[model samples]
Target: MTYCVGLLLETGIVMLSDTRTNAGFDNVACYRKMFVFETTGERVVAILTAGNLSVTQTVIAKLRQAIARDDPEHSIMRAPSMLDVAEIIGRTLNDVHVAVNERMERTKYSASASMLVAGQRLGGQLRLFLVYEEGNFIEATDDTPYLQIGEHKYGKPILDRVVTPETTIEVGRKAVLISMDSTMRSNLSVGMPLDLLTIRRGEYRVSTRERIEAGDPTFSAMSEAWGNALRDGFLSLPG
Candidate 1:
């Protein structure tokens, strides 16, 4: 399993995903779950994937193939707006899931995948979407300016408490890292290194992209601070 989250804020968008993929206790490997595409000042998009690795990888490969064609109608880079991009991704994911599952049917194995899409076009608003395996998707709204996929329950509480449309990019980044830390502590299937991406509104390009390795000092310090704060908060409550 994996854990991926995207935050839609007034200033921009923030996304994070872990790299761990596990088939069993002894069969663990690292594979990046974040993919980004951009034409630098014109358009930018980021995808965070979760679920069956085969399905997710095929979906990404097909999307890249479409982009390589430069077909305005089919390429996410040429899609009119973020909504169109989401639709394209949803369709691709659904198609890939069906094909992979059919191939696996002979062995009674099944494959499925989901993704979180976030991006902005040259003249469009920043948007975030959660795409399901069935070619359907929902966008993040002002009421709930964040979307998450995989091993999400353990990390959701921090997002619910700290994320909002008004959140600053800095705060949103911290919130997501803390959320990931919480999930990692509670779930063995999710591990590091992590991919973090931030795209500021109107830039139509990634403003920051960082890979948090297992022993990254800054992330380590942040994680420690968060744990300490949580413990202090719990102790402060009246008994």
Candidate 2:
């Protein structure tokens, strides 16, 4: 299990994901779940994946292979718009998911996975999409400017109450980190270090990419503050 979230704010986009992969109590490991593709000034696409590690990894690998081979029809960098890039990723994820599930049919394993795709190309609109296991996707709209996958329930309340399309980049980043922190505290399957990325509007490139490890001072302080706030708020309620 894992947790990944993406916010599409007016100033830009913010994405976060945990690195823990828990197959079982005894089979736990860390694997990067955030993948970024960019051509410095031309375009930038970031993918946050959750679900079966095998399925997600293969889908991303295939996407990269297409780019390395310069296969225009399938390469995300060559897509005319961010929408088209989402389509390509959706298609790839769906295909890989089905194939992997079939191969694991005899076992007790599953190959279901989902992804959050966010990016922009030079002269294109910055957009975000939630690609499901079925090769279908939904875009983030003004009404709901965020998308989340994998162990998301534990962290959704903060986003629902605070995030908006008008949120500034810095605020959006803090929101996501708090969101991830909430999930981590409630669910052992999702743990640090975490991958975080941000893209400023119109830049056509990633503005920041960071890894927040367990016990990182900034994150730790924020998490502690949030906990204190929650307890205080609860205590203030009339009984």
Candidate 3:
């Protein structure tokens, strides 16, 4: 299991993903789940994924290969618009999902994968898409400026309370960490180090990228402080 979340705010986007892939009680591993493609000042896109490692990794590898290809037909970087890029991703992901699922059937393994895509092309508006394993997708609108996949239940409350289209970049980043902290406390399958990024609107560049490890002092402090505050708040709540 994994936990991945992305927030599109007024100033930018905050994305985070855990690196855990659990096969069984004794078969758990870590793999980076965040990816970024940026052409500073022109295009900036980030993908956060959660699910079967093979499916997600293959999807990413193919996407990267497609974009790096010389043929315009396969390059997502040359897409005319953000919508086109998203459509391309959806189409490719769906194809990959089908192929991987076919193999899984014989092996009796699950190929569950979902990804959150967020980015902007120079002349295009910032857009965010939640892409499922089936290849279908939905964009984040002002009404719901965030998306999450995998082991999300434990961390959703912070996002519901503090994230919004108008939220500041700083706040969104903090909120995501708090959300991750909540999930980490509840799920052993979701562990550090966490991958995070901030893409500022219009800059088409990633402003910050970080890895929050198990003993990162700041993260540890934040998690402890958040927990203490929650405890105090719970005690003050009306019965």
Candidate 4:
């Protein structure tokens, strides 16, 4: 399991994902779930994946291979717009899932993965999409300027209450980190270090990419502040 969240704001897009993959109580490891592709001032794409590790890795590898070929029809780098990029990713994820599941059928194992894809191309509007296992996706809209996957329930409340299409990128970053912090406290399957990426409107490139590891002072301070605020609010409620 994992927790990945992406916020779409007027200023830009903010995305974050944890790096923990647990096969069982005794088998736990860290693997980055965030992948970014960009050509400065031309285009930028970021993918946050969650679900079966093998399926997700294979899907990413295939996407990379397609880009290496520089084939406009199959490469996300050559996709005309962010919408097209999302479609390509959706189709690839679905194909990989089917192929892997077929190979694992006799063993009774399941292979499935979902992803949050967001980016922009030169002269195109910034877009964010949630791609499901069925080769279909939904785009983020003004009414709901965010998308989440994996153990999303634990981190959704803050986003619902604090995020908005008009929010600034700086505030958006803090909001997402708080959202991740909430999930980390409640779920053991999602842990540090975390990958965070930010893209500003009109830049056509990723402006910030960070990794927040365990014991990181800035994140730790934010987490503590949020906890204290929650307690204070609870205490102020009439009983």
CA lDDT, every prediction? 0.94, 0.94, 0.87, 0.94
The reply for model 3, stretches above 4 Å from the true place, is none
lDDT of 2: 0.94
Clash count, candidate 3: 0
Better of 1 and 4 by TM-score: 4
Each candidate's TM vs. the true structure? 0.97, 0.98, 0.96, 0.98
- For model 4, the stretches where C-alpha displacement exceeds 4 angstroms are none
Would you list the clashing residue pairs of candidate 4?
none
What TM-score does candidate 1 get on C-alpha atoms? Answer: 0.97
Task: Write one digit per residue (lDDT tens) for candidate 3, span 143-188.
Answer: 8888999999999988999898989998898999999999988999
Candidate 3, residue 203: Cα displacement in angstroms equals 0.3
Q: For residues 1-239, write the lDDT of model 2, one tens digit per residue.
A: 89999999999999999999978979999999999999988999999999998889999999999999989999999999999999999999999999998989899878789999999999999999999999999999999999999999989999999999999999999999999988998999999999999999899889999999888999989999999999999999997
Error of 4 at 81 (Å): 1.1
Question: After best superposition, candidate 4 residue 221: deviation in angstroms?
Answer: 0.9
Candidate 1: count the clashes. 0
For model 3 the TM-score comes to: 0.96
